[model samples]
Target chain A: MNEMIENLLSHRSIRKFKSKRLNQQQIETIVCSAQHASTSSYMMAYSIIGVTDDSKKERLAEITGQSYVKHNGHFLIFCADLNRVTIKATNDEYENMLDNLENSEHFLVSAIDAALAAQNAAIAAESMGLGICYIGSIRNNIAAVDELFHLPKHVIPLFGMAIGYPAHHPESKPRLPIDAVYFENGYQDHEDALDRFDEKIGNYYAKRSENNRKDTWTDQMKRRFQKTIRMDVTNHVKNKGFNKK
Target chain B: MNEMIENLLSHRSIRKFKSKRLNQQQIETIVCSAQHASTSSYMMAYSIIGVTDDSKKERLAEITGQSYVKHNGHFLIFCADLNRVTIKATNDEYENMLDNLENSEHFLVSAIDAALAAQNAAIAAESMGLGICYIGSIRNNIAAVDELFHLPKHVIPLFGMAIGYPAHHPESKPRLPIDAVYFENGYQDHEDALDRFDEKIGNYYAKRSENNRKDTWTDQMKRRFQKTIRMDVTNHVKNKGFNKK
Candidate 1:
């Protein structure tokens, strides 16, 4: 395989990081690469917040319950932003601004746009020999996060990313078998494939280097789904003026 | 910048493609790279449908209103899938399957997972000297697209991708100014930066080889937001058994 493909295949979330900071050039290049990611209809309905203050990072670390948030070289929050367009419309005296932004389709567009940009940023950071981890736990308290970032209406923080020089290199996690994830022409039943994968994952969890346990994939999933997680996100999005319809 | 970063910054959508089909090995490697993308809580809440039948491609092209779908080497639909998890829970006799899969948080997770995987697949294809275009227009008639793929409930088709050797390479579209998209510590008003960028975009559009026009970024956005596009996706996702809470 080529270098790029190899780099992509070897990706793992980095939790521990060196104390050194990324230079200005690296940060600029990474953000530029993110900007280059394709957007739906070129709407570019996303914004990124770079948190560099030590106190702010510590607060974010507390919010996310991830100590690594404070220790990373850099922390950035990717937001699904319809506010930019709203502002533009108001300034230009365009009608239907609120109606357009309140629909579920626009909300989905912004969410997908933020994700595509963040993935590009992740890949770029990895290619530059930087380790990165996505912190979805930031959504554990969405309102507090929005307040912390001074986010306005029509702008919701989707996720955060931590980037730095790696201090730890964990083994890659096992994935579902190809047949289970990729179907031909139409969706197909993959119960047998999933059953076999459960055994493989069970072995993987039992044999991992750290935090090892004896549990299958289904076991973990069952425990996770026992109760709802982040149930307030829907209400929060609505309060933020999205999905009103 | 490194080769990988340069490749990322140089990305442009390929609308025209050579009629050559990808070898099985190349397709496998691309999908493998996609599988390596990070998933929220390891839910792996996504699936891919590879459509190679000519008649099916033609139908998809009609659904998307993009003729390039028929000319690409390959086409794949990325799906936000909660069905697999629900099925596993049912088979394993776990409770709360419907409750877990019907929430907004899980729906967002599945959408983000699908986008992350699709971006990785795009980069992998580009690294192999292939071209790709993400077809969000597939959402224009999502119900039809789902029917064409015979998708089950809890599985929503998110977007389609067309990949092939490049028959045409368009210039990269301009993005918003860095200050406008990236903020420090907290969100900031970037009206000035956006105003400056409007001029840059106006020039870009006027000088482009094809579809030349004299319109600023704000102009385009104003026209776009004048009416809602794809207003049916909300109901479609509900029909697919997501966001029911």
Candidate 2:
């Protein structure tokens, strides 16, 4: 594998971090790299917030149910923000912006834009020898997160990422067989595909050190699905300024 | 700007592509890079379908409403797939994999994972001197897309992308101002941020050649938002066997 592919293939999420701080130039480089990502129609309907405050980090850690949130060297939140565009289009000239982002397409565009940029930033960071972990639990309490971020209408926090130099290398997680995913012309729906996948996952999980937990991937997945604690996101997202309609 | 950042900053969608075929090793390298992206819980709940067959490309082109789809050197469809994990979890010692994916978190995770990987693939493609354009209109006819790919339940096409040697270099699109986003400490609302952004966008649009009918960013956004063409996705995605309940 080439350097990039090798770096990418040996990828693993890093949670623990060293105490060193990244210089502003490094952050700027990553941010610029992020800004270089493809935006839907150049709308650039996404924004990122770098979280560095101790209290804020603590609170975010508490909210995400992941205790490591506080100690990470960098915390950045990516938001699907059409608020700027919506209001801009509506305010002057010929169109209303808020009315423009009410559909599933724009929403998808915003999220995809955010995601694309985040990936670039993550790669850029990794190239610089930093480790990172994506924190999806930021959305566990949408309204609260919105409040914490002072997010305006038409913008929602998609997720937060914690980044830093790794104190220790975390084990690389296993992935499903590429055949299980890459279809030739279209998606193949063999009813037994998932069953076969589970066996592989079960073996993968079992091989992990016991410190990681003995639960099969399915067990964790089942537990996650059995509850509906964060189900209000649709309504909360709508209330926060995105019109799902 | 650094070369990567310059490439990123100068990114423009390339719809027209020269008929240059990507080698198998190139495809594998790009995917290996994609697989390096971060995944929530290391689940990696996503897939990419590489379409090179002429008839299949023609059909996908017809479905996405983008004529360039058929001509691109590479055509890829990225999907948010939860069925793989769900099926595995259910078939073995468990019977609730499908149920696990029913929750919003699992759905979001899959989508994010897919987007991250796709972005990596895009970057990899660009690094190799290829141009790319994302096809969000695939959602316009989700059922058709699903059927075309033989997608099973819990797998939804998020977006499609066409990559090839560029026939033309479209002008870079404008982005919203940093002030409109990038809140410090807590999220702060800014007044008139939208007006300023609109002016920037309007100026950018005005600078484009007059013959380009879709000149205004706001206008394009309005066209996207006001149209009801894409609303079928909510039900279409549901029909693919994902229980969003």
Candidate 3:
């Protein structure tokens, strides 16, 4: 495979990072590449927050439940933003009234756009030998994240990513089988596909250090499902101006 | 900028494509690259369906409300899947009995994973000089798409993409100003951000032909938001056996 393909194939999340920081130019290049991503109707309905302050990062780290959030050399929060467009429309004397920005197609587009850009940035960073990890925990405390980031109306933080040189190499985690997930024309029921999943997951856990939990994928998933984690996101998002209706 | 960054920056949606087809090796390489993307906890909660049959593409085109889908040289559907994991867990005697596959975390992870992989595939295709257009309309008629693809429970069509050698070059769409989207530590509420947005959008529309409709950004967004387009997605997803809660 070519270098790009190889890089993509060998990709892994690196939570541990070196203390060295990324320069503004590198950040700019990444952002510029992000801007090059496709937008629906040319409306780039997304924004990114570059978090650099030590104290601020600490607060964000707490909000996300990822302690490493504060230690990463570079931190960014990607957001789906539609308020900007609405505001712009109103200013241009165009009819730009949006009763609900949160639950509208506007939010989904912005979120997806932000995600696309974030993926580009991640790939670019990896190409540059940077290690990165996406912090989904940002949703653990959505309101706090919004407050910390001073997010405007109709802007919601979709995900956070921490970037830096890798301090350690993590194993390439296993993925579901091709047949299990891959469908033909319509969705096929793969009744037997999971037969191999348990074996593979068991082996993966076996290789990990005993100090860590020896739980299989199924076990972990069940444990996760049994409890309510961040159960307030729906209400919180609604309060934050997402009109789910 | 490097060639990779340049390719990313210069990316444009090429609706018109040449009739050339990609070899199987090329397809494998692209899929392999997609599989290499980071998955949440290694669940790899996504699958890709390659569509070479013309009739299916035509149907896909109809579903997406884009006639171009029928004539695209290549088309593929990316799906968010929990079937692989769930099916495996069910058969594994040691695995937990509780079903977590229907939870919000599972749904979100699968969506994000699918999106990341799709983006990687898009980038890989572009690197090989192929043009691609992501089809969001697949979500518009989820049931129709699900039936077309024979999707089982716990699988949702996230998006579709058409790929081929370019027959026509499209314009590079403009992006919102960096500040309009990017914030610092928290979200900065700038009162005039919207006014500036109007001016920039007006500028963009003014540069296009009168056929462009000169629709302000807000006008287009508001039109889309006025009614529910993907209103059934949540219910459809739930019907797919995913407990979004």
Candidate 4:
């Protein structure tokens, strides 16, 4: 593999960070990389909010329940935004566009758009020798995140990213076997050694320096799904004027 | 900017491909890059279907109404998959996870996970000197696509990436201004020169080699959204046992 592919394969999300802020050029380059991601029909339905104010960062960290959000060198909230299109429609008297943006299809478009850009930003940051973690916990308290970010209707914060120098290097988490995730022409589903993957994860956790756990992947997943999580997310998003229809 | 970021910034959707297929090594590298992307709580809620059969590619092209889909170096369908979890739940008898994956939040998680992986694949391909175009048009006939791919329940294909050697390198589509899509601490929305963006897009469309048009961005936006597109997406996903709640 090339150095770029090697860099990509070696990704490990960093939760603990040193206090080293990204310079202006790095930030711009990362954002520019995000801008270049292919959108669905050029509808760049996403935005990045750089939270530099200490208080705001603290509150955002609180919202996510992850201290890294506040303590990271730079915190960015990636938002799925159709508000810009709504703005254009209202300004240009294309009122039907508002209804269009409210559809579930547009919701998927904006969410996918935001995620693609955020992944680019993540890769760009990682290539620059910085460590980053995706903060999906921002969605745990979606209303607070919206309030904290002052997001408008048709714009919702999908996730956050904490970028900085790594204070600790975590082990690269093992992914599903390539056969399990990739199919030939059609999905190939059959019984496999579930214990094999769980064992690999189990070993990784066992050998890791911090927060060791004996739980298998399946156990964690079951524990995760059995409880209600962000049950109001749909209501929150709908009230924000997205997917209301 | 570094070469990687430059490569990311230089992305252009290639509609015309030289009929060269990616070698096994390149394909593996690209998929590895995608596999390394972060997933929500490591659920890894996605799968990829490689449509390598010529007949299937032709069918996919017809489904997408894009000829390039039929003649790419590789075509990959990124799918948001809660079905894998459902299968695990069935095997291990943790049925609550089934209900969990049905929630709207998990739907967003799966979609975001798929997009993140797809973006990584796009970057990895571009780094290897391949061109890519994201195919969102598969949603036009979701049922046909599902039938063609034999997608199981709780697995929805979010998009496809047609990667190939470029026969044509189109100009990078201009995006919204950095100031427009990005904010500081909070979202900043105010009226600016909408005509300026319209002019920028107008000039881009005017200068491009293929299919030049006199339409501005706002005009295209109005035209695209006014037409009801993919009205069945929500119902389709719901029928697939995702996000019905």
Candidate 5:
């Protein structure tokens, strides 16, 4: 495989980072690489907030329940921002600004746009020899996150990413078997493939150097999905001016 | 910049593709690269459905209103899948399985995971001299798409990506100014940046070789956001069993 594909295939989330900061030039180049990611209709309905204040980082770390948030070289919150388009609509005196921004399709569009850009940033960071971790737990306290970031309506903070020099290199976790996650022509039954993956992951968890455990993938998934996870996000999304229909 | 960053910085969506098909090995390698992308909490809540049948491709093309879907080297629908976890929950006899699978946080997690994987797949394709175009228009007719792909509940079609050898190379579209999209510490006003970007994009449209026009970014966004762009997506999402409170 080529270097780009090799870099992509070897991706591992880094939770421990050295006490060093990315220079301003590096941050700018990374963000520029993010901007180059394809946007739907060139809408670029996303914004990234770089948090460097220690107090603010501490607060965000508390929100995510991940202490590393404060110590990472940099923390960036990626948001699905319809506000830019809203601004244009208002500036042009469009009558359906609210209605247009409130649609579920646009919500999905912005979220996907943010995600696509964030992934680009992640890959770029990796290519530059920086380790990165995506903090989806930011949603654990979405309201506080929004308030902390001063996010306006039509701008939902989707996720946060932490980039820094690696202090630890963890083994890449196993994924579902190809058959289980890839269907040919149409969706197919993958129970057999899932069964195989469960065995493989069970072995992986047991063999990993850190956080070793005897948990199968199915066991963890069952534990997670046995009850509601983050039920507050519905209200949070609505309060952030989305899914209003 | 290294080759990877340079490749990322120069991404342009390829709408027209050569008629050649990707070999089995190429498809497997690309899918494996996609599987390597990061997932939230290791919940690999996504699936890719590859469509190669001409009839199915034609139907999908009609749904997207983009004829290139039929002619692309390969087409894959990236789905935000909670069904796998739901199956584990059901088989494990976990209470509240339905409620857990229906939450908005999991919905966002699965969609982001799928997008990350798709972007990796796109980058991998680009690395191999293949071209990619993301088809967000798949949402234009979600129910039909679900039916076409035999998708189940809790498995929404997030987006489709068409990959193939390039038949036409388009110029990279202009993005919002860096200041407008990247904030420091907290959100800031970007009116001046947007105005400058509008002028720059106006020039971009006027100078591009193919389908050249005099439209500004603001003009396009204003036209798009004037009314509901895809109002049916709400019902479609709900019918696919998501965003329910």
Candidate 6:
């Protein structure tokens, strides 16, 4: 693989990090790269908040239940923000604009915008030899996060990123088989595809260098989705004036 | 900027391709990079459909109303798919699993997964000198695209990407001011941030080599949101068993 592709493929979520801050230049580069991502209709409907204050980071750490939130070299929250666009549009007389802003499609657009930007930041950070982890746990308490960030309506804090020098190098987690995730011309059923992958991942969990355990991917997934996690996000997002049909 | 950061920042949506299909190795590299992106809870809730059939591409082009969709070097539909996970989780007795899959948070998760994957693919493709453009207009008639792709439920077609050797390199479109998108510790407003960017983008639109026009970013956004475009996506996504609280 080429160097860039190699960098993309070598991604791992680093939970532990050495005590080194990502300097201003590095953080700026990350945000700059994020800003350049392809936005839907040039809406640019996302914002990156780089949290540097110790108290705020500590509060975020408590909210996410991940100490790395406070201790990471850098903690950045990616919010799907359309409030900026509303400000620019400057015409409240246009009811369609207001309604459209609340459309689920815009919701999709903004969230995708954040994700695309974040992945660029992730790749950019990694290319510079920094380790990173996506803190989706931030969504576990989205309302509190919004309160912490003072997020405006139509600006949902989607997720956070924790970046730093690696204190540990965990083996790359296995993904679903190529056929299972890739199809040609049409989507295919994965009813049979998981058996081999389950075994492969079971082996991975059993023999990996750290935190080795014996569990199949399916079992983990079953344990995961067996409960309705983050169901409150629906009402929270709606209360934020998004996904209103 | 480092080479990769330079690559990330220099991204432009390439609408015209040289009619060169991405080679197998390049395609594999792109897909590999996508698969390696961080997924929420290892759910890997996404799929990529590579449409190689000319007729299928033509149909998708029709659905998207973008002729470039059919003429690209390679066409990829990045889908927010949880159908595979449902198959793997396999126990019909698990009501919560079924409920969780339909949760709006899962909708967010799957879509973010797809976006993260696509961004990696975009970076990988660009690094290899291939160009790409995101085709979110596929959601214009998502039901038709779903019909064409034979997608299962919970496999929403999030967006399409057209990849190829560039026939033309468009100048990078200007983004919002850094202060507008990046904040310190909290979400911020763009009330004043747009004035400078409006001038910058207005200049870009007036002076650009291709499709030059006279307009500011504010005007474009106002024109964009004034019409409630793709409003059917909400019901379509609901029909596809997503965003169900």
Most DockQ-accurate candidate: 6
Worst 10 residues of 2 chain A by lDDT: A88-97
Instruction: Choose 2 or 6, whichever is better by lDDT.
Output: 6
Q: Candidate 5's residue-wise lDDT over A38-142, tens digit each?
A: 898888999999999999999988888898899889999999998887666554454577766667788888999999999999999999999999999888888
The regions of model 1 sitting more than 4 angstroms off are: A91-95, B91-95
CAPRI band for model 5:
high
| lDDT at position A87, candidate 2 | 46
- Model 6 misplacement above 4 A: none
By lDDT, who's the top model here?
1
Instruction: Write model 5 residue lDDT over B182-229, tens digit each, in one string.
Output: 999888889899899988888888888988898888778888777566
lDDT of 2 at B14: 87
* Displacement of the residue A101 alpha carbon in candidate 4, Å: 2.3
lDDT of 2 by residue, A23-54 (tens): 77777777777877777656677888888888
Model 2 residue runs over 4 Å out of place are A89-102, A189-223, A241-245, B1-7, B89-100, B190-203, B208-224, B241-245
Candidate 2: give the TM-score of chain A: 0.91
Docking tier of model 3: it is acceptable
lDDT of 4: 0.85
Model 6 CAPRI quality: high
Query: What's the CA RMSD for each of the models?
Result: 1.4, 3.4, 3.4, 1.7, 1.4, 1.3
Per-candidate TM-score against the hidden true structure: 0.97, 0.87, 0.88, 0.96, 0.98, 0.97
Off by over 4 Å in 4: A90-94, B90-94
Give the per-residue lDDT digits (tens) of candidate 3, residues B1-245: 67667778888888888778777777777777788777766667788988877778878877788876776667789888766555534444213322445444456667778878888888888888889998888887888888887787777887888888888877776665666666677677654665566677777777864346465655666565555567667677778765444
lDDT of 4 at B186: 88
Cα error, residue B141 of model 1, in Å, equals: 0.7
Off by over 4 Å in 3: A89-106, A191-193, A208-219, B90-105, B190-215, B241-245
Model 1 chain B weakest lDDT span, ten residues long: B86-95
* C-alpha positional error of residue A208 in candidate 6 after TM-score superposition, expressed in Å: 1.5
Q: What is the lDDT of residue B133 in candidate 1?
A: 96
What is the alpha-carbon lDDT of model 5 when measured against the actual structure?
Answer: 0.87
